[model samples]
Target: MTSNTEVFPVLETKRLVLREITKKDANSILDYLSDAEVMKYYGLDPFNSLDNALDEIAWYQSIYSNKTGIRWGITLKEQGVVIGSCGFHNTVSQHSRTEIGFELSKGQWGKGIAAEAVEAIINYGFKHMHLQRIEALIEPPNLSSQRLVEKIGFVREGLLRNYEFTRGKFDDLYMYSLLKQDLDKINSM
Candidate 1:
């Protein structure tokens, strides 16, 4: 397995580039993170200022430095502007597991951009991070997110009632996972 401290991986797909997010991207980050509809199921309130976006970017850096997780900004190859972000967090290296999260601008929805970016990261998690399982926790009401993971080959394990407290209340999340073997099976077929 590769060390998490190594250089951040820049992933690519046919139409997207998954690269590290820097402070300069704060404005683009805020563009989506501050939207109430986009933040609805994200477990955090909409960002109120550019400072909040900067802080969020800092958290992404801290997780990488701490060897806990990684997040990548999603950009189009043609535009090179960040439209979204995705990555694994709450990583437990010893257990070979981690959780996945992602968000995109409302205007970019239904374009299959997120799925492309997420698939690249999932492959990286298994091959580079040596993770056995990558999980996605989706709020029950977030059917779109649930469908996204399912379309990516994740199996819904169950629901974790009140699994997290955010936005001033406890929320139930559905546990969805894609094991490394599952990916192998999909690829081999």
Candidate 2:
């Protein structure tokens, strides 16, 4: 097996391919941004225009290439479309510890794509990023996301009171995490 520290161009899965974001993916990302239902829990205003979306996509790609920590865009394998974005987030102490986040298209919900993407990113984190622990900060209104994290084996550490200003006001966020050792054991089975 390869060491858990090698960075690759992309990590391919059965249904999705984990890769860096691109300029061309801006419009699809805007699709996700336009949906009020999609952004309801994410705590962000709608993208004003395609240019705004393009700027966001460019930001993700440029920072990633420069090694700045942020979320990654999730692309569908067969369709080659940007259905959502998910990746390492919330850099604390220069990436020594960071959180994991994912957002998918409303059309693709309930298909386990988020889990698959999270699994791939988790493997990437453990194998390549030297990430000791991966955190998932979820909103209280989002029970489905909480379930997804639990199903992926992340333990609910506790509730962070007024941790994030989401959906307008400060919301108590749930902290969920998984260790690299636990991933090693889980994947070994």
Candidate 3:
């Protein structure tokens, strides 16, 4: 089995493919990244141009190269277009834990696509990366995402007040987590 630490792996679901985000995917991902509505809860402002997407892709590559984190472009299997991105960030190997983050185009909302992608990556984190815990820090106002994480089995730990500044303000975030034990329990069901 290939270790996730040594190589980035492509994860898949029935309708989606999570693969490395590349420069070629910039234009495809540009739609959502630049949409203020989509990026509302994100830590950064909406992209002003395709150049912003390119820069974001480069940043993703840099983190992977440094073995700091892995980000995947969430591609639709039928349409063959990237609709979003998701991945582990703020990874702490010694702690056997990492945080999850994701964003999807406004058009893709309410389709359960994010749930599928999150499930696949969560499995990869537990089974392939041997992570004991995976956490998600979400802006309190992102009800859709909070529901998504909860549906995927992440337990809400607590809220972090003024966690980080985003979109020109310090935002409160809810902390959610899933443990390896939780996955194992479900598998043994």
- Please give the clash total of every predicted structure, in order: 0, 1, 0
Q: Looking at candidate 2, what is the lDDT of residue 105? A: 94
Candidate 2 per-residue lDDT over residues 138-169, each given as its tens digit: 88779999998888789999999998775578
Q: What overall lDDT, based on C-alpha atoms, would model 2 receive against the true structure?
A: 0.77
Decide which is better by TM-score, 1 or 2: 1
Each prediction's TM-score against the native? 0.95, 0.87, 0.92
Q: Is candidate 1 or candidate 2 better by lDDT?
A: 1
lDDT of 3 at 115: 81
Report every candidate's CA lDDT.
0.91, 0.77, 0.85
Residue lDDT tens for model 3, 1-189: 113356568887889989887778889878888898988887888898989998898888876776667888898886668899999888899999999989999989899888888888888889988999999999878899999888777899999999898667888989999999899643432
TM-score, candidate 2, is: 0.87
Candidate 3 local lDDT, residue 133: 93
Given candidate 2, what's the lDDT at residue 82?
Answer: 84
Superposed model 3: Cα runs more than 4 Å off: 1-7, 184-189
Among the numbered candidates, top TM-score falls to: 1
Candidate topping lDDT: 1
